[model samples]
Target: MASDTTNGTRTIKITGKEAMLKNKSYFKTSTGDEAGCAPKKGVVTSKIKGKVYYTAWSMDVKFEGENVVRHMDLMTHNHASMPGNTPTWPYLDEMAVSKEEGPCKDDIKKEKEACKEFTPHKADGPSPCPPDGKPSTKDEADAYADKTAAKECLRARRCQLSPYAPTGKQPGCCPGQTGHHVVEAGSFYNVGRGGSNSTAIEGTANYNADKAPCICVEGCNQYHGTHGLMHTYQSTAALNSGATTQALPLEGGKQTSVVSLTYKQAKTFGVDAVGKSFPESKCEPACLEAQLDAYHNKQGIDDSTQCRSIATGYKGDEAEKAANAAVVARSSRLAAASASAPSGR
Candidate 1:
């Protein structure tokens, strides 16, 4: 039973309505394979005890209006109404709040006491020479110790005490050389086919886009491995590519009615960083939206030929000239230094 701070003082009992809606996304077939349920039509029905229950909560409502999108409650499927009632998954008929429960006071006290003892070890302390009569309090001493420890942790490339620390420990770096260029596990590259006289290429351990395709991250899948080196962060560029308009080829040289984007068009879409391998289904929505927008505007969506033009600043050809001048100036300085140095060879 998780408590949410937003709703305020309300305990959410998992009801049949809620369960049916939540699990609507997951429907199993007789063979155990799952499929999306088609939309249900007309008034919703729930067969109860060989009879019907006209519960308003069970009704699947659809809004009516032009350009208005239809939204269903989380559990309502396309075809199925209320789920088939079963004792194993009984519906919560009612919900009421009694004395709410929370962590025991003793447990809270114990946690606070333990926190006091688990203070991070400090690496430095103030000099014995203190201000006239000011003595450091326990809280101030602990804070100073924590600050010193934090500085040491950063210097040693250890985890920080902050919430965003990679590992949950005193703010210090990883135990070993974890971040000094290491690729994800199970990710490696081969220079060529496995055979005699085959030697791996030099610098084959580092990731270079010119060399090989990106590899999926290991435990934390944000980075991609290539060759032997790893590149941080996967790009979503592939998902945002342009339109496709080709009929998929079927067996026996037949063509399917469905259209898809051409390879050129797909590449034209925003897919440089993410690479070129993705399912047609993934690119369909954006393609269709672009096509629809183009079709709508083909007839000139607005009669007014609204046009405006503006210019700003000089071209950067001058900036390039200035950069070249600076380079020449630096070359002159290097030549002067070389000439002034005494040579023995």
Candidate 2:
């Protein structure tokens, strides 16, 4: 087909007039199919007004795809782009709660709001739990009967991923996955398994402490064994690597999510070791040390990475490598913390 700029019309060519597009077949370049859950990445983004915008996808991304899809779609995906949250949980803060805390309150609140929901599937997330968050009904009880679903549901609820193992689990909750949270889940006010350190994770919910997801996983795999993954992943983007929505396919599994940090967000880091220049990232020793331990935990050296977490600002990407890394690292720590499944030993 051709267009005439002046007349607004032009001659057109049709190659498959006699056949359907699918029936034509010759246009096919490859065979493709869509299936499976999407993994939480070290980075994430959304599209806004035809422009690309970056920010945390959802805090409840133990499973990916669904939230990413919701954020990537035409209708739901940012008629806007990133960070335009409502109100804060604590009204307005007089003191910084998270040791890893920085600015970007609106972004943090929005992420916490997003974390309220989750993917309704076996992968990416759990089957939707009760809107009221109760398993008192027979149907609700039955729904939670599925061990995996219960865990995912708890994850969706921002509760502990697993409650008991041979050990206690870190509070795996966070908008930024830091010691502080953008919002509160009952008592998840501003604390993590690591206490109130800059790198501590937001702890699980107070109510679901005895849920099936927490109980079933005990005496087995260390729960939150892969937390290092999300802990770092939810953080990235204070860099130049923000994601491209064109690349974020909702139907696919595990895409290499990324974020593009703004120079403005970068300036928040203040100055570098030389004191004459600003860094592209806001690297906190506590957070950096956590990332290094996560990388060194699994196989070592670390393909896992995170930059400028939500604690600093929502301007980076996250990856799945941290999950695999923490599995092995939990080996020695199992006596203290927990994993969600069998330790794979």
Candidate 3:
């Protein structure tokens, strides 16, 4: 089959019978397939009315076909090359270094800047307890009870209550197996083995010969009997004594006095801030000291770890470490002052 140049007319130059045979397979290829085969990338382009146009277009991803199929296809794969021929994070060092200083240098400088301030915070009282003969009359006893309550409350807030221990046991209440309770029971016989109880009647009242702070309207009602007027705090946060209707004497059990932590102290203690407050209650000296020591010694460090980690990631842990370091260094000065106080131990 041939095309005449003048009018683009197709012609067959052969005998009539041969021409007939040629016409039968005029558009056929060697593989017995049709001519004008489609391109592998699909759809061809054309210039119609002097404007470029496409017969069709595809948006699907380019897939790699077998070598045999690729050879048979008309289109070539230009996209199947290295992805940009370079790593994605090319400027990693620039990103990490941010400024003229490297990350390590910046960290050191940051640490120095953090330590610029040098003034120390004033210390706390020696102990939560008062003078030896402090709690005498009902008013004095109530005051003592209140102080004790505050300290214990602080302790409970700092330490997590152990699930294995009985429910009534306050946080940090487990001070080893010494069997020495924080607040002893009221009965001389130790009748009620666990939980809050007051001192028995036989226990001596330490009211001194000096002027009493307040008058006793009632006798020593340690167990919340009519002998004394009971002081009640109705907050659900408080522990419940067995007797519901009767107000119990200001007995010690459940926490009373709690440690009040500054942002600094909380850091040192490895405290988490999820349940945080502006000024949170915390543990007493003994328990806090133990915790601090555990943080310090557990890792075989010469001094306590500046901050103990409480599952708040690196930022929280680092801050706590700095705070703890400050507290331990300041403890000696505070202790000296405490020793000179009237009721200091």
Q: All candidates' lDDT scores?
A: 0.22, 0.23, 0.22
- Model 1: per-residue lDDT, tens digit, 83-198? 22210111112221221221122222232233322222111322211122211342332222222222222212111111112222212222211221111111111212213322
Instruction: Provide the lDDT at 41 for model 1.
Output: 16
Q: Rank the candidates by TM-score, best first.
A: 2, 3, 1
TM for every model, in the order presented, reads 0.14, 0.18, 0.16
Candidate with the larger TM-score of 1 and 3: 3
Q: How many collisions per candidate?
A: 23, 33, 22
TM-score preference between candidates 2 and 3, better one: 2
Backbone clashes counted, model 3: 22
For candidate 1, the 10 contiguous residues with the lowest summed lDDT are 306-315
lDDT comparison, 2 vs 3, better candidate:
2
* Residue ranges of candidate 1 with Cα displaced over 4 Å: 1-246, 257-259, 265-271, 274-345
Model 3: how far is 154 from its true place, Å? 6.2
Please, what are the lDDT tens digits per residue for candidate 2 over residues 1-345?
011012211233135232111101111111111122234211122222221121122223222122221111111111122221111011111233442342333333433344434442123553243333323443332333232222333332332222222122122322212221111111111222223332311122122212211112111111121222222333332233353322221112322232322222322222111011101112232222222222122111112222122332222333324433433333334423335444211
